[model samples]
Target: MEFKMKTEGFHIELPYGRLDISGNEENGFRPYQLLISSLAVCSGGILRTILTKMRLKVDDIRIIADAERNPKIANRIEKVSLHFKIKGSHLSDEKIAKALELTTKNCAMVQSMIDSIEVCKTYEIIDS
Candidate 1:
């Protein structure tokens, strides 16, 4: 991926569209927002696949992610908390927990930042 410099930051042309990234929030997407989004989406997608393979009918999956950043050290991300609200049928707590475990294990983004960032995952199964 090649990024071209813009007035505010940089823009990358992806197959889907163009993504603008900048330190200022008003200009475009922030770097840290993208980082957290990548991790959250990756885990959510993997969990959805795992639940499907387990034969659970999933109606919808929503993820809420919170991150802790330390300003003293270049404002680096210290920890990330992911809460998943899954709307489905015949979902058991045990199976859902196992699926979450598998998701964390399989998600490449989570694994990539394993050493540097602390990631916590929790879930709620909602009957639909």
Candidate 2:
């Protein structure tokens, strides 16, 4: 990861694209927003891998993520809840529960912060 300081804030060059982060709320991505999005997508990818290995076909996976932050004590992220919507066929709540259990255990980002942050997961399986 390479970061260059710009007049407005900073430009971080990543594999996907250049991430412009600034204090200006309307101008660029906030640092905390990046962490929240990364956590969601990282978990999403991990879940997809697990499902494929289990021979389950899925049409789409939507990860809706939100976080609670405390600014009084160093602006820490207290908790993150991820609501997963999996669109597929013949999917059962039992299967998803197992998959999510593994996802929480295996996702690198989740594992990194599991001790510090409350990572809660819920799911809905939509038959397609």
Candidate 3:
């Protein structure tokens, strides 16, 4: 994989895509997208690990991610929102909530992002 960043402009190019390295306030999808995705994957990974340890049977798991950007001169991502839908049976609400909490706490991506910015999360439990 190759990566390149412009010194003058706030743009960066990756092997697959280009990003605004300088936090382009005028453009879209700055470096923050990568950070946000990191959180999503991290949380998912953590939850998977915890559930496996607890032997909870999961039918399906999906995470929907979105972010709110601040369109100012050095535009930055201000807020990140996560919506999670979990499909599992024979699991208590408390156990699921605990797993979610632990996932947020342990996920390095979420943990790092939360320290510098605000991240919101909501979950839905589905019987399957």
Candidate 4:
């Protein structure tokens, strides 16, 4: 996990590959997107594990994040709304609610951003 940095135009040269980053949809992932992804996957993975422990059949887990950024102050993300779509069979609403609650309580990435960004979550359970 060590490499020389390419300082020309917000680029990084890693051993695996080179990353070209910017706010626009140009080449690589924007730094803010990475932050959002960390939170998304963190909750998704933990939720999956919890569902498995509860013996629920989970066909798929899709997580999407809607983030709002301020144009005035450094374009920092003011809020991140996470939407969770769980496709499964025989899933109960009570279990789903509890699972989401556990995800909200356990995700480290989301906790880390609590002081800076407002994190909101929602979920839906679908039959497989």
lDDT winner: 1
User: What order do you get sorting by TM-score, best first?
Assistant: 1, 2, 4, 3
Model 3 misplaced regions, further than 4 Å: 5-30
In candidate 2, residue 113 scores what lDDT?
A: 87
lDDT against the true structure, each candidate:
0.96, 0.89, 0.78, 0.84
Q: How displaced is residue 7 in candidate 3, in Å?
A: 14
Least accurate 10 contiguous residues by lDDT in model 2: 23-32
**So what's the TM-score on candidate 1?**
0.98
Question: What TM-score goes with each of the models?
Answer: 0.98, 0.92, 0.74, 0.84
Error of 3 at 96 (Å): 1.2
Which regions of candidate 1 deviate over 4 angstroms?
none
Cα lDDT tens digits for candidate 1, 40-110:
99999999899989999999999999999999999999999999999988999999999999998999999
- Deviation from native of the Cα of residue 86 in model 2, angstroms: 0.6
Q: Which stretches of candidate 4 lie over 4 Å from their true place?
A: 1-3, 7-20
Poorest stretch of ten by lDDT in candidate 3: 1-10
Top TM-score model: 1
Per-residue error (Å), model 4, residue 59: 0.5
lDDT of candidate 3 at residue 79, scale 0 to 100: 82
**Global lDDT of model 1:** 0.96
